[model samples]
Target: MPKIPAMTTYDAHPMHDRVVLITGGAQGVGRGIAQAVLGAGGSVMIGDLDKEAGAACLQEWQVGDRAAFRQLDVSRESSVRRWVDAALARFGRIDGLVNNAGIADPLREPLHTLPLEKWNRYINTNLTGAFLCSKYTLPALNKANGAIINIASTRALQSEPDTEAYAASKGGLVALTHAMAVSVGPSVRVNAILPGWIVTDAWQKPQKRHTPKLSRIDHQQHPAGRVGTPEDIGALAVYLLSSAAGFVTGQHFVVDGGMTVKMQYA
Candidate 1:
């Protein structure tokens, strides 16, 4: 009989020496991913629209040189370009890009009452933002053979009322993930993460941060026996951005505490 191999210790810094660029990384899920990358021994360049939040993150993280913040509006191509340029200049290389910026509000005016401007707002920020970031960072990513992780929503798969615009944007993001995966394969990997019911009340900026008010039903409803957190998504983001996921590409991973797989009745 063959002898069993000795167990190996888990690696604490899977992303050591690497650099990642995260948009909307000043707070919420983006901030969680940023912290995860740092914990994995990677550097981060964070871009967000909220200057105050960005400053707060910088102050709280205290990771000198390893973390940076830039004010960015991902909807604008020029802003995206500058953010990419800054990251490349600061870190000299970008091994990963996390497109985590977007309007998080799902319930808007009803579709019939939703104006075209509001719809455009969703598309421009949520969908086009990813495109612009990908477009600007592709060259650097290609050089490093990096990865792109789009933070799509499970709303793309299942939705509530008054979520048409948000759903469409995330659904488009899902399609974009696969399309880009095929288009840029063998050089840079692209993927999407669909998160559901992640409690971000405590993940916000200083002024906005608060303890999450969750009910027993919220934890019990999920097959995983708990509500999801930003860290849950962060762990997967690290994996998807690492060498271990070399064979994984063009996939949409649902990180929702198994909520999507469970059946529900009215």
Candidate 2:
């Protein structure tokens, strides 16, 4: 196995006592990030449209430890503002906001045949949602000199059949990250993380099956020789949110296991 780069020092829990909010933290990568921050002794707020799951995560992680839950609709300005406000009210400050909530409806049709409604839905939920959340949370983040980590995808750089909306939305997110980083200026740091194929429970669905037909064991055939886990993304999220990454901003960091760098000639 290859060594993963130690992006930042653990340093006795660098983000301890800080307040962090993660959208869509009910499960998958967002949940993973929440756990990571909690473990590091930071307060966390889990925001999502799924009330049950979000509440469950809050109960399970106990953000007030400090941790809590907030029902949020990223596409709605009012909803987004409420959650940010709630986090600030609960913790008295905001240290970071992870725009990790997103939706991707599988499409069988090409762009020419794709439904306009579907395209709009994708852009609204995946792209515009992130923008709205950031816009509202910027003030809180600026107050804490915090970071905004937008969860993008490696698909932003590559394309797949029937994945036009997902790719386009993520691509737009990457651009937004840079623009936000510049706009937030010397106060708040904004960056994008492009995660590759991660086999989460949601990803286990037949409709969400990954391509190239490789077995679980062959996951490591690429340079790093394995599929990624939510924990991997979580660790990186923690680092980026911590003071250790103060010098990093306005960048798109790819966390794939070298899959994009390899060519399949077979």
Candidate 3:
């Protein structure tokens, strides 16, 4: 197994005494968020569908002392509820939730020919899954005066051909983020992060990890001169959950290297 990188230490633990729950926290942006939370002195409950990957991540991060992992299929209410209950049983309090699990396949089949199974899979796993997680975790969040951060995508706003299912699900998530914020306000803060072209292959499970291969043209196209990283979203998530962003809620922060703002003539 590859060694974990040296973690940057912080003098002040912004998330001290806070317990955050993250679905699909075993890899990619979810893993980055989990690491950032730990680095800032917060405990995390990582729920993922891949048990082996989740366990490997917790161990590799050396966050076993401050983290817990549970197998969760966010689309299933039973699984979502069980994960939430287990986190509560172990940590006894919940301060924040990162709804970061979802299928990201860009199935390009025309809607007229799209199978119902394909459509439901994307909607159920992406949109409905967030709904179930939020539903099950909201009570604890309210009791702790906590927050929710939904990991959406720029596809929610704009999309390419054959991206209807994924795009629609993400679009619904954006709407739900604000609706939920309004429904649970005065107690819990809700927000969404729409990350564009974040390269997360390096953050996947060790066995599946690979070095990213991006050409100069790819990096040059973005206004930021490069693609985004999991860390970019992670840092923003931690900040949103912090008291620093206390007055911020029902907002969608886009962290896409400003790619969405650049118009393409081709």
Best by lDDT: 1
Superposed model 2: Cα runs more than 4 Å off: 1-10, 62-65, 202-214
lDDT of 3 by residue, 141-185 (tens): 999899999999999988999889999999999999999999999
| 1 versus 3: better TM-score goes to | 1
Worst 10 residues of 3 by lDDT: 6-15
Alpha-carbon TM-score of each model against the true structure: 0.96, 0.88, 0.95
Off by over 4 Å in 1: 1-10
Model 2 lDDT tens row, 1-266? 99998785458787787888898887778888888888887878888887777766756554444778888888888898888888877788888999999984445578788889989888998999999988888887888899999999999998768788888999999999999999997899988999987757642223433544558666867589888888889899999998889999999999899988889677
Q: Quote the lDDT for 218 in model 1.
A: 96
Number of clashes in every candidate structure?
A: 0, 5, 0
User: Residue 62: error of model 2 in Å?
Assistant: 4.8
Error of 1 at 176 (Å): 0.2
The residue pairs that clash in candidate 2, if any, are: 63-66, 63-67, 64-67, 220-225, 220-226
